[model samples]
Target: MLHIVNKSPQERPSLDACLRIAESGSILLIEDAVYAAVKGSASAGKLAEAAKKHRIYVLLPDVEARAIADRLVDGVTGIDYGGFVDLVADHRACQSWL
Candidate 1:
């Protein structure tokens, strides 16, 4: 499955929802959601834990308006806008976590 996330921990319900998902194979960070990896993001540790535990692929656009794309965490993969589309084409299903 694929997940498109556009919310950070500053938002509550959605953050909780994302943690509860059973299968989010590839997670795409878009818009302001990219801040989840920025320094001091409250959810960074939790998000990292989720990725490791579930083996979920964390994908973020190579260029983000909110955070330094090149500084993405170890488990996160940098992708382009077109790559997001390709991921959906390659997956059987997708869910927008935002």
Candidate 2:
């Protein structure tokens, strides 16, 4: 399963809710949700822990747009638009946390 979140952790609880309910799968952070992948951010530690059970991905373009490319967490992977399409195709299903 692919759990997609596009909200900022600082502004919304969508990421937290998804993390709590998703047991094992992939997580793709798009839009403002890319903020969660930044090092030293409030949600970084939680995201790091989640990475143990879930393959964490962040949209490269989104991260670049936010100018947070250099601060991404250790285990978080960055993907381009094509990679995003591949992820959706690879997963059997996806849930978007709006």
Q: Residue-wise lDDT of candidate 2 within 3-85, one digit each (tens)?
A: 99999999999999999999799999999999999899899899989999999999999999999999999998899999999
Tens-digit per-residue lDDT, 54-98, candidate 1: 433434543455447656655666677677788889888878875
Quantify all predictions' global Cα lDDT against the true fold. Answer: 0.65, 0.96
Candidates' RMSD to native: 2.5, 0.5
Error of 2 at 81 (Å): 0.7
Clashing pairs in 1: none
Worst 10 residues of 2 by lDDT: 36-45
How close is every model to the real structure, measured as TM-score? 0.77, 0.98
Error of 2 at 78 (Å): 0.6
Task: Give the clash count for model 1.
Answer: 0
* Model 2 clashing residue pairs (backbone): none
